[model samples]
Target: MIVSIKADIFNNDKNSSDLSDLMHFFKKGRHRMNLRKIDDFSAFENSQWKQTLSRSDIDFLKEGMTIVDKKEIIVSESPSDSEFRIKEAYCYLQQPLSIVVENYEYEPVFINCIFRNFGNELITAKDRHWLKFENGGGASDNTIKGMIKELFNDTVFTKSKEKYLRCYIIKDSDREYCTINQDDTISIKKLPEAKFRFLKDMQIPYHILYKREKENYMPDSVYNNFLQTANKNDKKKEFSRIYLEFNAHQKDFFDIEKGFSHKGRLKNRKSLQADVQTLFEKLKDGKDLNDRQYTLIGSGLPFPNLKSDFSEKFNAVNRNDLEKRIEHQPLLRSEVNPADQNERNEFEHIINEIKYLL
Candidate 1:
């Protein structure tokens, strides 16, 4: 299946311009280099000064330029098991401040920087999943930074410049975001409005977002702190901030593994408790577990106490389904009638054990 990805773009930590323009940029004092505090671009170009340039900057410039215009990502595949890499565009907004660009949408939206609405509140897009990018129109007054200041410096912008904190996803044909309808348009459902804040600039796309607590998105200590906040409303805001900040620091580059894969984590562990009985029933009745159940529950429970507890619950499952895979003697996926076995699986004793702690 083809899924489109989108988001607003922010500019940050950029001093390494073209090889030829490096000296001119710094000699004018309009540029700043965070590359180990090296002040001169000419000095940066010197061979010995290579050490001062960030390896990340050099890696990004591998295409021989600083700017990346567009990229295609593989989102999913056909049921026949054929690979399907979805083509996604990262088109910069055309006259973004003056007009709307519709090629793609933004991801993990930064709230404070979204386009303005009538009351300067949340706005809508074509769908509930749409995001807003920072409007890049206002000029900065910090003349000391030169051209870069207007485009890149946040501190230079006057308080008069309006920064809208919300956006909408009604389709352009629906014409919901505009104050005066741009064309004769029809309005669909106006979706939920949300709040956001600016994200820190990072050069690569993110692998995950922390919309809520999950083992992959959060650590135990951080999650424990999140649990400490008493008010439910405040907790929601705090989580939104965490998601925004975490997403802001991520960048999605092309030609890499750039899609969601940890679906096994979404399994309902409590629901799986019933499946555990079916699993042992099949095993005790001379049946076996499938490859998915075995693979997802790899390496058994990490904690010994949890394993001991789980073992007590199912006497027949003392040996984990995962450990049955010997190098040569592979576990069978269809040794019995699949209809005879429980259809819903991918659950193992270890999976439920982890969930019990949460």
Candidate 2:
């Protein structure tokens, strides 16, 4: 977390001592400090506060603390003005800003949060499963709206009183794609436009997933494990078998939440049906159907049977196993993509954004 310091806090000897202690405390932890100017007071040598600090403290201020204009959680001595403030030394040391994820128990987001805040600590399987049972599902439109309303209320009514409270939201983009041309190139569309507007209007910081959702980012090993454990009679076992045969592009764009034939559940039902038909038409010439065409056609399943929730079930099982491994190791990057540079970069970008909020 980036802790911002008020320039006025260094105006006196007592405050200077507190600031020095705070700097040392922050240095020992992962948190970074930003020296901010308050009102007309400058934090530099030209200001009256420059005389309060000892030579070493001044040297540390230059070399150690990060100076930035942005404000996150503020550390202040005398109350001036700031939404999230740490007024005293005790509160500063004890309380860190909480990060609000879409679902706290979702392993992909939770593991990243844990990595940013606590580093790579080994978590027990029992505790991990407990988290999974507690709010592990994706947030609905209504749920996201309620969260946005709560954040607005907190910012308007509570934060005005200077009580320290800050939160960052991260959710999947839920983007979908379709084949755009004869070359099998795809065009992506970002879903849930209203939610993006709400977050922006509320001035809340957030990160959206580059892929469709958390399941799309799961490692190949997770799929293999799910296939190994699945019952031979299970429909999802068959679905997993077909899914593993897809190319990288098909896998990346596939909808894990609702398989290719979720017309009833999807808002763009007509467009989805059209895409399926278009892919089918392109491959109907009887020259062997490619991976992309096969994927879009519901893995060659009968139209009536395509509506089965096999994809959702397959996703759930793979996600659960991935969560177990993450709890024990917390190494998302290593498991996410070891060979693909683009995928690795995307994973790193998401993690760095989450860490910045911390």
Best by TM-score: 2
| Most accurate candidate by lDDT | 2
- What are the clash counts of all predictions, listed in order? 25, 1
Ten consecutive residues with minimal summed lDDT in candidate 1? 251-260
Question: Model 2: which residue pairs collide?
Answer: 1-358
For model 1, give the RMSD to the true fold: 24.2
Where is model 2 more than 4 Å wrong at Cα?
Answer: 4-7, 13-30, 34-63, 66-97, 107-165, 183-185, 225-237, 257-272, 276-344
Tens digits of per-residue lDDT, candidate 2, 1-358, equal 5566665554444555555556565555445566655441355455554676678666765664554322356655554445333434334334343344556544444344334334332123113321121231354334445443454343223343223323345566665544556665555554666656765655555556555555665555655755788677755556666666654444555665456555534333345556543433333233444545345435333223332332232333333444332332212342212332333244344444443443
Cα lDDT, model 2, residue 213? 59
Error of 1 at 161 (Å): 34
